[model samples]
Target: MSVHELAVTESVIAAISMQLPDSQVAVVHLEIGRLSGVMPDAVRFCFELAGEGTCVEGARLDITEPEGTGSCASCGTSFPARDALAVCPCGSADVTISGGAELTIKAVEVTDDV
Candidate 1:
């Protein structure tokens, strides 16, 4: 999983660099949810290996863990759910998950000139 994530992130950075040839990326903000099945520590460890010799070698990685959100089937109320427990306030076990499975690059900080 960690190796896969590293490959994906490296590819994304490469694509961005190609599109913006004049820019030097400084930071990459990543939105990592608890339900995303990705370990932040694993990703961070592999990121350095993946970025070796690349333009993002020394770039900073900012990870954000978004709270899980779910909708209760009993009351139809949507609210933040526990990250791991994922229990609804209404005590309904038939809740449908709406969010917290996201793994995306929120933003990239870049310098026009280095």
Candidate 2:
């Protein structure tokens, strides 16, 4: 288990636990971009253990990974980027990348028993 992912999952669980102190969390929706420097698999692996005994325990974790978008400064063309160093089809090296590197909690679902 990666310590980074474990710590991140712990924090996420703690936040959910604090918000829904008495509720049983049913799901957690998250967005993790491809270039976010975070490994989705690692986060998934850490979720269960990190959420143990908390509101997030046993909750389903859903993650979405947005692809990297890049815009070429030279050609003004926007395209998908496989990596930070992606070159534009126009052969432009001056590219600005975005839509990758996202780590956010989009939503949370809880049981009515709370």
Candidate 3:
């Protein structure tokens, strides 16, 4: 088993446990950046294994990929930047990343059995 995905998935479980210690989670929503270097499928698989016997056990992991964005310092312009190291639209390499490269827990669904 790869440690990378397991580590991240464990973190997610820990975070959820902190807030909803009593409730059982049914779904886990995560926002994955296109340039975040994390594979959605791999994370999902790890989540299944890591969540065993926990509140997130058998919970579905919903991963959403947001579009990458950046801004040009020279031209004061903004555009989509799927690649973080991509150049600016004004023929300049001076581009600042505005979005993407994110791995966040968006939301969680739990039954109101409490």
Candidate 4:
């Protein structure tokens, strides 16, 4: 998983670098929810490895995991969800997961070489 995360981070660096040509990445902010099935620490560690020899090298990785919430359509009850297969306490499979499934790059800070 860390290996995959490294690859993903590398790709993100490439994409973001294109947007800020001749600049150095200072920080990378991300939102990794509980249901996203990713470990923030692992991702952060891998990010450092993946960023080697790239503009993202030495950049800080800020990760945030938002709380998970879901609703059971069968009972119209909303509850906390740690994963997608959150079974409602009322014994219902008609569950709708909300939040906690995000794996997004919120922001990227870069410094122009100038």
lDDT, candidate 2, equals 0.89
Instruction: Supply the global lDDT for candidate 1.
Output: 0.77
How well does each candidate superpose onto the true structure, as a TM-score?
0.77, 0.89, 0.92, 0.85
Sort by TM-score, best first: 3, 2, 4, 1
Per-residue lDDT of model 3, residues 48-102, tens digit only: 8889988988788899999888899899989899797978878888998888889
Tell me how candidate 3 scores on lDDT.
0.88
lDDT of 1 at 23: 63
Winning candidate number (lDDT): 2
Can you list the residue pairs that collide in candidate 1? none
Q: Pick the candidate with the highest TM-score.
A: 3
**Measured by TM-score, how close is model 4 to the native structure?**
0.85
Error of 3 at 75 (Å): 0.7
Q: Determine which window of 10 residues in candidate 4 has minimal summed lDDT.
A: 1-10
In model 4, the runs with Cα more than 4 Å from the true position are: 112-114
Tens-digit lDDT track of model 4 for 9-93: 6777777768766678898899889887777777877887778878788889888999888999999999999778899989898
Once fitted onto the true fold, the runs of candidate 3 whose alpha carbons sit more than 4 angstroms away are none
